[model samples]
Target: MSDLAKDAASMAKGSAGLRGAPHHTAKPLHDFKAASHDLSALGALGSLLKATGDIRDGMNTLSALTESLSEEWNAEAKLLGEVSDAFDLLDVLLSAAARAKKG
Candidate 1:
């Protein structure tokens, strides 16, 4: 069994002992208080687990976004390279035209 399951089992056992005890004694009251504190700790643990799940989800989303951005940047880079090549060809053609006109 998991550590969490073991902890929950132990907490349940500890609280169960307080159910039939007289309310007048100091030890049962102390035990009850300790059980209440344990329950509070369990609640905090639950919240922490939820927060951890949220963080995992956020990280997955960020990873997907990064991948999408990388694809887009690659495409944009290819397009820019093509545009640069076209500009270079245009410069060559214009230079040739000017030489032909002069000759």
Candidate 2:
């Protein structure tokens, strides 16, 4: 198989693994002042923010990778576009969660 095909297959397998992973819901902090006094809640918020940044970074990397691929790779472009869309949706959801937690 071509290297591109191999890489795509590997990405697909990784995606499948993500699909089966357990979900985690962050506890919403309605009051920033109250949450600031709680060490555990602060820690959780920090973790959530860090995760959101990481996801954004991953999305950027994927976009760069897609841009570097040849124009003839239409199938790969379509696949990467779907992946990018998912990342965008996730980013929006995370942003909303962060905002809700702040309020």
Candidate 3:
């Protein structure tokens, strides 16, 4: 086997050892029911209000980021247009110079 394959196998075995052997144990039904009930209760009207606030904040952040990106794109586009114009001017100058030389 290749060194890479051997190394991978060794790493897998090491990780398996780290996840100690599994053991079976029974949990009380009341504990499980209470935990489930508490989790559901935790998402009350207050939780909904908090989620709404978080969503509004997220939308504001998204708007700001979008505006920033748009500004950058506009600036870059303007710069690219200028560079293209300069290239066109240079082309015209070069053509004139060539014609003059030929004549």
Which pairs, if any, clash in model 1?
none
lDDT of all predictions:
0.52, 0.50, 0.50
Candidates in order, TM-scores: namely 0.53, 0.31, 0.52
Q: Give the C-alpha miss distance for residue 75 in model 3, angstroms.
A: 0.3
Task: Give per-residue CA lDDT, model 3, range 1-103, as digits (tens).
Answer: 4343444455445444433221111133334433433444436663766664555465556555655655565565555555545555666676788899999
lDDT of 2 by residue, 27-76 (tens): 22223323334445335665766764554465556544544442325455
Each model's Cα RMSD: 29.6, 22.9, 22.0
- Model 2 C-alpha lDDT versus the unseen true structure: 0.50
Candidate 3 least-lDDT 10 residues: 18-27
What lDDT tens digits, residue by residue, belong to model 1 across residues 1-103? 4343444455444444433233334464455544543444445665776664554465556555655655565565555555545555666676788899999
TM-score: the better of candidates 1 and 3: 1
Off by over 4 Å in 1: 1-49
Rank order (by TM-score, best first): 1, 3, 2
After superposing candidate 2, which stretches have Cα over 4 Å from the reference?
Answer: 1-72
lDDT of 3: 0.50
lDDT of 2 at 25: 13
